[model samples]
Target: MELGYSDSVRENVEILDVVSASEEVGILDDVINQGESEVVHLKVGMKFDTVDEIYELYRKYAQQKGFPIKKRSSKKDNGVLRYICFACCREGKHKTDSETPLQPEPTSKFGCKAKLSARLDLDEKWRISVLVLDHNHETSPSKSRFWRCNKKISNHVKKKLLLNDKAGIRMHKHYYTLVVEAGGYENVTFEEKDCRNLVEKERHLKLGEGDAMAIQSYFSKMQKHNTGFFFNIDLDKEGRLKNIFWADGRCREAYKEFGEVITFDTTYLTNKYDMPFAPFVGVNHHGQSTLFGC
Candidate 1:
């Protein structure tokens, strides 16, 4: 059978909207609404979601158990593909970097290592399977935020960064605002350089290298359909589009009548590609604003 969307899981999106070929395993007489109600198959602690969600659940469980927890280890660097396993634990003292040659001896550390591991099962919607939930230390209330996960960035801060990114805010400005919103730069898990890289990467990803065949494909479709459309494009020496003008048959006819005394406005909204957007306007016989070109 022919496949659907190329990628399996969605990015910065909901998996509920993504329907795969596997979802339509059997063709029936009547179509079923996939979003009506999902088949929630699970045991007591088992759940269906991403590994990050599982980690959050684990963290919440540890917190409810009156113990501060930290991620012991993870199987992968990114995504819940194939297989991913992570261990959450009741943390103790910080360890010294004894592997370094310049480090001193007798590392000052604590004595708590209660841990639990959650593994992703590939067969069942990447459901989290609790591998182990063991604790050797006595359970107690959290008094301080010292031995917590230092690398854990809060979801609120992440959402703020993503929202600002969508709002077209630059990185340095965003970093300043984010630091203040996060209480201080020291409170944030990642560095300023990380935010900068993320913003730069987002810029590249959002406005990727323009599709090379887009213009050609458009022109091909226009020629194939034999539409009476006029178009002009001026490119710089580097094959970059500097100026483009297009007018459909109807627009051209309107321009032919209200052609004289056309006022061109070069001032308008700004674009990232540094291309000028000028609109040609004119007043018709009825004294109403009429468009000539752009």
Candidate 2:
């Protein structure tokens, strides 16, 4: 047992060594070389070992051409993968709604027709079938990193971010340290926001049990008794509860009678989490202040 365990540990160390060496060598050299026409050219009938290899080559081409590519589609036959397609990140038309939202979101889609299609051959190798290099809009290599497809937080960066977070390092300082270590912002594949998001995700995952679950349970119980009770819980990107609002049937009935003048106050400091306790209040027919919602 000891011998097997030692062998496994040695194998793991060897794998780590290889990974470290690869990271030290870096992919920027290849991406930089892609600036040359001969290096970045993607011709139909190009063969690759795997789908990722096809993506890697196309991605280098996109880096040179200053466009982002996304995995658009894939096909499988009898549980065997066969065909795949990669398209410009901004290939589709943005659907507009009749009623505009209060905070309208930005969109990248513009019906750009740039794409690359590849198919699997009998030799078990993937071959490019179609290639469309024409793009409808301007492309900027300098701004390519801002695109979702181009930005990636590698495992090494994640480890560093986790370590810095555990040491109580401020986000800005840690990000700056990473930028310095990477040589410049250009060499860093991801931005500060991406690091912050990863840190938040890790922190949330570490919090095995949160107050949000208990609050949700209480809300569920309340809902069972009062079907008319309406409740809403807003969660952040990491699934952490940000805000919660609930109103019972009685509150709704009271609101119908005395909601002519409703007051919403959040001045109360009533929780250990330092979150504000907001409540909707109104005056009843008997001139008594009644609770409407919270």
The model with the greatest TM-score is 2
Could you tell me the lDDT of residue 66 within candidate 2? 90
Instruction: Kindly report which residue pairs in candidate 2 clash with one another.
Output: none
Per-model lDDT: 0.52, 0.77
Q: Which run of 10 residues does model 1 get worst, by summed lDDT?
A: 27-36
lDDT of 2 by residue, 1-294 (tens): 355558756655544443345355653442222233455778899999999988888887887689998999999999999999999988998886647687666788889999999999999999999999999988988776677877777666676567757756677766765565556887777888988878876664232356778778899998999998989988777675578899999999999988899898788864344467889999998999999999
| lDDT: worst 10-residue window of model 2 | 27-36
Candidate 1, pairs of clashing residues: none
Top lDDT hit: 2
| Per-residue alpha-carbon lDDT of candidate 1 for residues 1-294, written as tens digits (9 for 90 to 100) | 863544533221222212112232321211221221222222334655666766555555554454566556666536545445444343456656678767656632345544545555545455554455555556653421233532343444455556666656555665654444446644444666766655554444132245434755686576457576666766656565556786666667778898878888776645554345788888888999877667
